[model samples]
Target: MTQAVTVRRDGDTFQARLFWWHAARLLDPGSPIIRVGFENGPKSFDDIWVEYDPKRSAQDQYGAPLRREHVQCKWHVSPDTYGYSHLIDPEFINANTRSLLQRARDAQLAYAPDGIGVRFKLLTNWRLDRADPLRQMIGTRSGAIRLERLYGSATDNSKAGAVRKAWRDHLGLDEEELRVLARTLAFGEATDTLDGLRDNLDVLFAYVGLRRIPRNESAFPYDDVVFQWMAQDRLEFDRKSFPAICDRDGLLGQGEGRRHVYGVKSFEHPIDRLEERCHQVLDLIPAFDERYIRSEADWGDALYPALRAFLLSAARDQSKLRLALDAHATLAFAAGSVLNIKSGRHVELEQRTTGERIWAADDFPPDVNWASLEAEVVELDPQRPDLAIAVSLTHDIAPDVRRYLSATVPTVGRLLMLTPSTGPGAQSVACGRHAFELAEAATRMVREARGSSPVAAVHLFVAAPNGFTFFLGQRQPVLGPVRLYEFDFEGGRDRSYTPSLTLPISTRTGDPV
Candidate 1:
């Protein structure tokens, strides 16, 4: 009995953490989730409830908008695996009177009679049985059973058909009724451990401007707070009330003024919940799909004009802009130039390579060790008017830049290579301050190298973090007319560097300077 009590307590903590995760998103004005509830929905799947605004509802794998999600969290002290057969077992689902399938059907009927916009989810720490036929039917990306697989092929003699027959017989339903229930049901494996859930919550807490759990602290204040709330029967929260509760609990962090998020996506997997996080989104995937530009004209005609217009409008709002870039390095630099240092906008870059960190110019003190640059100059043609600058902080891209310049741009007379003193690698740049100092040093190097010569334009190529590239662009005015270049990382388009946006965009005419 004592062991059972302890097990229940641990399980409650896990459920509380999951509740806090969805609940905290209510602080974001742009979040689609308008309300979150704990232990307040259908009794069987009532661990948590997340209600989305119908106008901005999140879509499922099949692209159907979801209005609400009823989640049931099952946590265990030891590793366990379950298969299709176990789902119908009363002991496995812990059903007193009705099985999980029956509860899910009832919940759908109550919430969404037509089954247009509701989901019943079972989130468990237990793994799916590796050898089970159920594993083959589940969609790897969706975590939901495939509709065709659930219905099975024509004969109904396949393994998936057998599992479907078992479930249908257990539920006492016809094929159509079974399809409706299965469509609304999703079974997902929770990958996070107890501590891992806390870590994820810390990230969300920071984003919503809430106090984070202090490092190395033995006591978990968040878990304690959830327990307190549970005792008081304060289980429901919405956009307005959630922040009030957080403040009353002393969970609010130092207030930063109005934050406006912007997303620049050029990839297939866009930023998740971008509409929830950003006030505006600039999608460049149409012009530059994945890694390669579809056409040479697309950069100047479509991508740059759209990006510049977006930044110009955002800067006029006079709010701190938080930029999340899932784009190529060149476009990242171009974005920086649009919202240049003179724009007087406090911009924060979301850096996510090693781990998630918000990098801002003033986040840390200047590191003197990171102030200097290792410079190498190569004179290709002294008579030519153009000079190429290769900044390699992430990796050595000088070789690739040189090859591209030699084959394509004969007008580029010289090439300048700039790297960190410690040499180039992923961890070369430490933080935002370090990146800012490096950008300053790089700008000064370009000025000294040009030295009263008739340098027509500076061709810029950078292999660095998106944050660093933005910082570099902020300092572009110090260098003369600068042209940015993008490389085909995916090798779909010639496997070479192509010129992108030319910086120092004219303010009066909105043209390249």
Candidate 2:
């Protein structure tokens, strides 16, 4: 499985956090801090010296991005229970809550009653990338606030040695006792005592195997990715988020398959509100709202059972639908997509060499105007074809066979092209003698679609290497292959062109280059 570590952004780089999975394994739920402990997860969870180091961002070449090797992490939750700052620092406090909610949702979403025992589970993973650096950082980082967050008062035995001794002396009774001691370690006005003990397997976690969480990127905020991965096979990931309590609709699955999510709250609330939040969390996925995936009436019957369960609960002050869309994994070796479309083959293009046989459209020049639309319908009164308006298109070809056809394609046709996000955004080397002619073609497509045509709107599409910047003239036009397409909104017409070369994209998204 591809390793992933959960992280929250601290200024520029992400600060590692302890998530639900670690808390479930390390903390006992019955402890006094359970509500706050699980609710805060790592955000408020204090840090003891974890044996992990951060990977800094840097750069070498001039003007190249520089990855900083280190930055003082100021976000560690304060160890002072009395520290008035955490309650005051809105950002930190909200972050603490958000982190907890994310994990809680993860736990609940992944819950399996048939499992052997009951325990909160954080369904995530990480990697060995920081293995070496973590060890080295730990060596020089001794005596630093072990738990970055607040813990019990340090004993005089020595800040480092004392904390260890305190646990060693009173706690380490047995495997079971270890769990209790871990939970009870929290300090508050009232204190709880540890009791049970079990086998302490003959082993050592000399390395706590604790690393700060990693910050993963998302495309459509949250919900968009859900559907993109679920309804649409556009993007794939190893794991994704889900919520614990799902309403009847079961939309949280991202339409891909069953997913797990967690639900968290500091205080009790009503069920409808909870259900609303559940939908709200789901709203964060792919299409924003359920309606985006399916029509309301179409999904009405399917969602009835789930809605009834929630409505009844609400009537009795019992309806509670946890908005628990936790992350899930759709991870696997999905095929690589075509990035750019230049006139060339794939194998030799990886290294960006001219060795691959690349030919422009001119190399296989056709005297005939490929822009003819005699077979295509334009004006439509109900799938009626739009006017097959003729346009004066002209272009010169390059020695490499590059040719730009400047003819205006009728908007009332289907425009087939690869998604721009999937490939490089490119423009053909051609000029329109009269740009208005091309604009008129677009107008016609829209008009036909409006005239009772089945097609609703004319879609204008374009492909760009990096996403388009509107200020920089980047358009949202459906980014597809190398070609740009403008078509009638209502008319079902076709306007496709030959592809050129392809570009390379990193497994990680949002890369500019």
Q: Which stretches of candidate 2 lie over 4 Å from their true place?
A: 1-117, 120-300, 304-513
lDDT of 2 by residue, 134-190 (tens): 111111111111132223334424444343344344323333332322221111110
- Which prediction has the highest lDDT against the true structure? 1
- What are the lDDT scores of the predictions, listed in order? 0.78, 0.21
TM-score of each: 0.64, 0.18
What shift in Å separates residue 122 of candidate 2 from its native position after superposition? 5.8
List where candidate 1 sits over 4 angstroms from the true fold. Answer: 1-22, 35-51, 57-209, 216-258, 268-272, 491-495, 504-513
Report the error of model 1 at residue 35, Å.
Answer: 4.3
Q: Kindly list the per-residue Cα lDDT of model 1 for residues 150-172, writing each as its tens digit.
A: 66676469887888789889989
Worst ten in a row by lDDT for model 2: 195-204
